[model samples]
Target chain A: MKELIEKYREIGFKLTPQRLAILRFLKGNTSHPTAENIYRQIKEVYPTVSFATVYNTLQALVDRGEVTEVTIDSQKRHFDPYPKPHHHIICIECNKIGDVFKDYSDALKLPKNILKEFKPVRNHINFYGICRECQKIGGIKYGNMSKSRAGCREF
Target chain B: MKELIEKYREIGFKLTPQRLAILRFLKGNTSHPTAENIYRQIKEVYPTVSFATVYNTLQALVDRGEVTEVTIDSQKRHFDPYPKPHHHIICIECNKIGDVFKDYSDALKLPKNILKEFKPVRNHINFYGICRECQKIGGIKYGNMSKSRAGCREF
Candidate 1:
C-alpha cells in the first residue's frame, strides 16, 4: 500500500480523498467489481464521490498497469486490480468472479493456421462455473445478479 | 445463403425484408461488426431500419445460438454470426479480428484446485497482435476505442 501510494504520488496523480478510498478498496480486492460496484461501495464513506471519480481512478490504474478491465460480462465492465496476469472463472449462477492465478501461456500455443496472419501475444481465460452457494440454491438459472453475496467468502 | 434462409424460415422466423438484409450482410461476414455497424450498413439500403430492430434481431440470433457475441473489445460489443465455437486474435496495432478455429478445450482444462469451488463449462481465448495494415499505417494511437477494427484486408 505504501509503495502504491508513493508510486501514485510520483506519477503526479493528485490522490484525492475519494481516490485514496478507492485505492484502499482496490488494494487487495479480489471481487473483480464493476465501476458501479466500486462507486456504490465508496459512496458509503465519500458521499460526494461520483462514478466519474471511480472510473477516472480505475482508468489511471489501468494506464499504470496496476489494473485490468475485464469484458466478460455484457452489462458492465469489471475491473481486476491485481497487476499480475491471471485467469478468472465467473459463476454462471451468480456474477461472482474467482481467480485462477496459474500461468497457461505455454499451453496456449496457437494452432498452425492462425500463425499465418497473427503474431499471437498474451491471453486471458474466463471459465464459466457454478459456485458452491449457487450449486446449493438449486436453480436452472445462470448468471443471477440479484443474489446478494454478503458474507460469501472469496477463494 | 438459400439454405440458411430456408433453415431460419423453417425455425419460425418472420424473414422480413430487413431481417433478410441483415442476414445477407452477416451470412459470411468475418468482419465481426457491432449492432450499430449492422444498423449503419442496413440503413444505407433500408434507411428506415431502427436501432431497436437491429438489436432485437441480434438478441434473437443470440438466443437461438445463431451468433456468438465477441467481448474481446471493451468499447462496444461485436457480434460474430458464426455458430461454430472458435478463438479470435485481435491486432493491438489496428484492432482487426481474425478467426482461430482450433479446439483448445482439452488444453484449457482448469486446475483441480479451482474445480473445488466452481464448475467449469466453456472457454474462449483472445490473442492480441499487430496486423499488416497497422504496421504500414505507422500504427493506431492506442486508446480505449483502439479495438474498433477498420481497414482489414488479407495479407
Candidate 2:
C-alpha cells in the first residue's frame, strides 16, 4: 500500500481518501471488478464517494498501464490490476470471469491476408462456457433446439 | 435478400417491413456495426424506425445464434452478422476491428485448474494492436515513458 501511494505521488495523481480507498480495494484484486463494483464497495466505508471519482481513478490507472480493462463482458467493463499478459474465460450463463495464465502466442499467428493489412500485437482470449454451478443448475439452455423451431424462440 | 426472408419465415421470426430492413442491413455486413450505427443507417431509409426496434431485433438475432455481438469496443456493442467461428483484431487507436479466420483452438487448451472449475465450450480471441494506418500516422504513444516521468503522465 505504501509503495502504491508513493507511486501515485510520484506520478502526480492527486490522492484523496476516496481514491486511496479505491486503490486499496484494487490492490491484488482478482475479481476483475467493474467501476460500479468498485464504487459500491467504496461507498460502504466512505459513504459519500461518487461514482465519477472511482471511474476517473480507474481510467487513470488504465492510462498509465497500471491496470488492464477487461472487455469480454458486453454490458460493462471489468478491471484487472495484474500487469502481466493473460487470458480470460467468462461464464455465458452467469457472467463469472476466470483468469487463464497460459500463453498461446505460438499458436495464434495471423493469416497472410490479415498480416498484409495490419501488424499484429498483443492478444487476449475470451472463452465462453458454463461454470460448474450453472451447469449443475440448468445445463445448456440455448442453441439446442429442433431446427424446425430453433430460430423462432426468444432466449 | 429473398433467401434471408425465407430463412426468417421458416424460423417464424416476425417479418415486419422494419425488421426486414434490419435484416437486410446486416446481411453480408463485415463492418461490425453497433446498434446506433444500424439505427442511423436505417433511419435514412425509414425515418420512423425507432432505436428500440433495431436493438430488439439484434437481441433476438443474438439469442437465436444468427449474429455474434462483438464486445471489443468498451463504449458500445458492435454486431457481426457472420456466423462462422472466428477471432478479431482491434486497432487501439482507431477502434477499427478486423476479422481473423484462423483457428487457434488446437493451441488454446485451458489449464487444469480452470478446466476443473468451468466446463470448456467455445473461445474467441481479441488481438490488440495499432492498425497499419495508425502505425503510419503516430506510432506507439502509450507505455513508452521515462521512469521518472512515466507514472504521472495521463494517456
Candidate 3:
C-alpha cells in the first residue's frame, strides 16, 4: 500500500482519501469491476462519495495506462487494473469475465493488405462462452456438451 | 436487394419501408457504421424517421442473431451486418474499425481451468493499431514505426 501511494505520488496524482480508498480497491483486483461496482463498494466506507469521483479517478488511471478499460460487456465498461497485454473471455449468459494469460501473437498474423494499411500495436482476443453455472441453470446439458466438444475438436 | 427483403421476410421480420431502407443501406456495407451513423444517413432520405425506429430494428436484428453489436468503441456501439464469425482491428487514433476475416480458433486454446469452468463457443480478436493516415496526421512517424516493427517482431 505504501508503494502504491508513493507510485501514484511520483506520477503526480493527487491522493485524496477517497482516491486512496479507490486505489486500494483496485490493487491486484482481478474481478474486472465496472465503475458502478467500484462506486458501490467505496460508498460503503465513504457514504458521501460521489459516482463522479470514482469515474474520474478511473479515467485518470486509464489515461496513464495504469488501468485498462475492458469493453467486452455490451451493457457496461469494466476496468482492469493490470494494463499489461493479456486476453479475456466473457460468459455470454452471465456476463462474467475471466482473464486469459496465454499469448497468441504468432498465430494472429494480419493479412498483407491490412499490414500495409495499418501499423498494428497490440492485440486482445475476446472469447465468448457460457459458464458452467449458467449452463446448469439454463438446463443445457447434452446440447452444450456436443457444441463444446466440437469447439475443442476444432482446436 | 430483393434477396435481402426475402431473407428478412422468411425469418418473419416485419418489413416497414423505413426498416427496408435501413436494410438496403446495411446490405454489403463493410464500413461497420454505428446506429447514429445509420440514422443520420436514413434521416437524409426519410426526414420523419425516428431514432427509435432505427434502434428498435437493430435490437430486433441483434436478438435474432442477424447483426452483431460491436462494443469496441467505448463512445457508441457499432453494428456489423455480417453475423459470420470474424475479427476486427480498430484504429486507436481515429476510432476507425476494419475487418479481419482470418480464423484463429485453433490458436486460442483456453487454459484447462477456464475450459473446465466455461463452455467455450466462439472467439473474436480485437487488434489495436494506428492507421497510416493517423500516423501521418499525428506526426508520429519513426516512433510508431519502431513500435509497430517491434510488435511485428513478436509475431
The residue pairs in collision within model 3 are none
lDDT tens readout by residue for model 2, A58-136: 9898887889989876667888987788988887766677889989998888998888767887989999877777777
Model 1 agreement with the true structure over A90-150: per-residue lDDT tens digits: 7766667788888888778887777766676678887888887877877655333446543
DockQ of each: 0.63, 0.68, 0.66
Per-residue lDDT of B1-155 in model 2, one digit per residue for the tens? Answer: 88888999888799998888898888888778889889998998899999999999998999889999887867788889988988998766666678899888888889999989888899999887766666676655544321222222111
User: Which stretches in model 1 have alpha-carbon errors above 4 Å?
Assistant: A135-155, B135-155
Q: What DockQ class does candidate 1 belong to?
A: medium
Better of 1 and 3 by DockQ: 3
- Candidate 2 ranges with C-alpha deviation above 4 Å: A140-155, B140-155
Ordered from best to worst TM-score, the candidate numbers read 2, 3, 1
The TM-score, computed over Cα atoms with residue i paired to residue i, of candidate 3 is 0.87
Please rank every candidate by lDDT, starting with the best. Answer: 3, 2, 1
lDDT of 3 by residue, B1-155 (tens): 89888999999999999999898888787777878889999998899999999999999888889889886966578889876777898877666678888888888899998998889989988888988777766754443332353222211
lDDT of 1 at B105: 82
lDDT of the candidates, in the order given: 0.79, 0.80, 0.81
